[model samples]
Target: MMKVANPPKVSPPANEALTKDARQYGVVIGALAGFCENGSPLVSLGDRPALTAMTLVDVGEQHIGMRVAVQFEGGDLGLPLVIGVVRDNSGVGSSAGASAARVTSECGLSATIDDDEIVLIARRRITLRCGAASVTLDSDGNVEIRGKHLLSRAAGQNRIKGSSVSLN
Candidate 1:
């Protein structure tokens, strides 16, 4: 019987091999280039090609030019993960007064909260619905209200002023 030579040991994939090597390098700073088709952010690390990365912090389109800390996820087969944003010591972006929080949704809805008040915005329409009652506001300056019953109560003066008003 002819002895079969041992098969050559196949190496891991490039990313997998890079992952092992990357561990020793620790976290790297990368800039957010843009977003991928699946909405994941693409980051540029040094001179390498842009790699798709997921974020541990809340990141949006506003963060496209910001630097972020990137590291390979240990259990995720070395997929790049954005751990945090790198903020400069300069107080340029920081507010001296009350801090504000902004949240943007995937569907074009956004909200901003500050010390004074909260603001909600939507591209097309915004609707507030509770049980059988619903209030809809559209970009065309149209407000529609629907409910089983409607009530109008005011502690002070109540006024209904519009281009045209109809009552039944």
Candidate 2:
């Protein structure tokens, strides 16, 4: 892949550019999962794993489950964040969505999916205009880039529930 491409509507998040005090870990979301004690393998086992792919429906359970472990996990979140975009093996939109915007917006930005191309609201905008369409889109066509790298485990408890996915 190219190092970078032309930006969309918005600019990238500032957090990714930090250079100090960063920690990494895996993101898991689903119904139920188990992380290997050795951190080697993750399996679905006809159900789900510790690192599960989840939707908004599972928020309640995920929140309560991490409470006990929050007092034990640790790490730093002040460093640059590098992420890898993740997709279902069959790819996105193929899951048969009901919305006109095939791809859901990450955190409210509009997005859409066209074959393999993902057009999204690039957060890389130089100026922050309230109604600029160039850096602000109103569609559902971005490729959701969810990474496997873990965020800082020491920042507190599991603060991120539906992990922040970027438009790749």
Best by lDDT: 1
4-91 per-residue lDDT for model 2 (tens digits): 5766564333454231222233332211222222322111211211232222222232221121111001222221111212235664
Predictions: Cα RMSD each: 11.3, 23.3
| Per-residue alpha-carbon lDDT of candidate 1 for residues 1-168, written as tens digits (9 for 90 to 100) | 877699667445456666667787788877665565478877666545567777898877777656778887662333678887777698322221245545454445555557898777878888878899999999998899999988999999999998898998
Which pairs of residues have clashing backbones in candidate 1? none
Query: Where's the lowest-lDDT run of ten residues in candidate 1?
Result: 91-100
- Candidate-wise lDDT, in order: 0.69, 0.27
Error of 1 at 22 (Å): 1.1
Flag regions of model 2 displaced more than 4 Å.
1-56, 59-94, 97-108, 122-168
TM-score of each: 0.43, 0.17
